[model samples]
Target: MAGRPTIYDVAERAGVSKSLVSLVLNRSPSVSEASRLAVEEAIAALGYRPSRAAANLAARSTRLVGVLIDDYTNLWFVDLVRGLRTTLGEHGYRVTVADMATAPPTENPVEGFLSMRVEGVVVAMDVPAALSDPAAPPVVIAGTRRAAPPDADSVTNDDAVGARLAAEHLLSLGHRRLGHLTASGGAAVVRRASFVEAVERSGATVVTIEHDGPTDEQAGFDGAIALLETHPETTAIFAANDLMALGALGAARQLRRRVPEDLSIMGYDNTPLARTRLVDLTTIDDNSFAVGIEAGRLLLDRMNDADARTGAGAGATSDGHARATHRTLEPDLILRGTTGPAPAAAP
Candidate 1:
């Protein structure tokens, strides 16, 4: 049986100490360039393969990061994960993904991540209260506003600004009675509030239809049906997400309501679904890739400094302490085929 190559073999070949070989392989900044080169040459000559587990134990850290996502089927989530992988890979970290698609709502994803001994965790779902463990590894939450504990961090697009932009677009098109189809719960409420505020500022009446469940095509369809039925005067609708906006499009088609001519609809998240030739939904670009990239960077930073304070592990703070270090990206409106000038009033 062949034995594994040892660091001593590399050190002997390079004419360096075992510590020098270890430092080079572990990427320690303290090692000189000449020393690092010698270690690399020695490693090549000896055909040495470093043991990841042993290296982690020696350094008291690991390069593995665990990412938890709400739904794997959502293309936006897929893109976000891809962005995270690309960024983390550049930093010599491997990502382990866990899809909580079928998990019960009450299950603690953070606990699962902890079990893996992940140095850091990135959550692409709504923030969970159970993640408030100061002793745990750092965490980064995306796509939701639930504040991380003092020890965790988070990254999100400017959802309120995105909603305002969508509402303003309709208002600019002379939409008076505007209706909103939005997801239920925390993030949706913020978007709805922004939309209503924007409409109110423009002296327009805002009628909102809140979905009973998660934001999806079904919610969009059902919400649109209710809104159109209750407020026939509504000339425009702004959905919280592209999926819901697509649902609104389906509802309009079913009712024989000509788009842009009879109504204008806009959505957030500017996902690929909105760009389909069949749908062509006008939407606000939340830049999901950028969000993922930022989240990945935050995780890397945490890994670099294990003692750093993050929002996820710190729990609720006083107003002053709770001031979230949120990174809010601006949203741009992409006008496609769905949004247009408001239809003229019926003769």
Candidate 2:
């Protein structure tokens, strides 16, 4: 009946305690159906929309999850976010994504999110030294392989296994001489090391690995050019990621090396670019969506445990924080048109 309706208005009209109204709004199972219905009816009658901040205060939690991504241009994060939302939404949690690329060089994304009092944080990028020692709040590392805080949980694809798969595919396709275009990221390091190991185990000639500054399409392009020049005999190439793989494709075209016909190219991440008709890159699917889902589940569990400990009148939190947990999902090898039998001449 006034300019705006608040929780007090909804509770008054519902003939229930404000705390009861809060429980119903939060979808607490303990709230009786009668009370829930009464709250709902009152909400409709008063046109009362609960503010997010208010709801958070009532729940004694922000219920906000921060997701920090390395770069937005990389399509792998699209599926990751989809999975994150699927799990987080069911539990009434909202996710706010921030790109590390856009953040101030002196300020890390995790600090900024913590300053806002987010309930949990998921670092989807490589672990920065600034976040190497998060003391409070749940922190989960997603899709990355860097040294994280002692208490941090991690959900990531086994990059070494994925690289081994790529190397196996290329070697099985009769590719004796290969090159790997990589960069300075942790994932790239693992992929490169594993790819080389797989190649060496095959008893084939050593593979040529080239690196660039950042992991991007341009880095891939430049690295490919350098690799091709230094190892002109390379019959196949594997990029650290799909973006670099696309660059390798460009290099092939410029060098007049027809894909699969003159050279085979493979990439990691199996991003949307790998599925495109023009690219059709043979790649290792890191199962980004699954990583996101696992990260969400792990973070939720951590938060719940922390809350339970706090409510139990424990003198100190559990030592669970001292022991880090890491989960690795297996990646799939997706074969596409970009890879085939090595050229007859073998470059």
Question: Best lDDT goes to which candidate?
Answer: 2
> Which ranges of candidate 1 are over 4 A from the true structure?
1-62, 104-108, 307-324
**Residue-level error in angstroms, candidate 2, position 94:** 1.0
Off by over 4 Å in 2: 1-60, 104-107, 134-136, 313-316
User: Model 2 reaches what TM-score against the true structure?
Assistant: 0.81
Cα lDDT of model 1 by residue, 105-158, tens digit: 886667877877787788776666656676666688777655446556778788
Q: For candidate 2, lDDT tens digit of each residue in 1-347?
A: 54567666777899986656665665656567988999899999878876654544447777799888888888878888888888887777889898977778897677888787787888887776666654546788987656766568899999999999999899989999888888887788889889999999888765555664778888888888888888888889999999888988998999998998888988999898789999998999999999989999888777655553333223324546468789999999999999999877623
Pairs that collide, model 2: none
**Per-model root-mean-square deviation over C-alphas:** 8.7, 8.4
lDDT of each: 0.75, 0.80
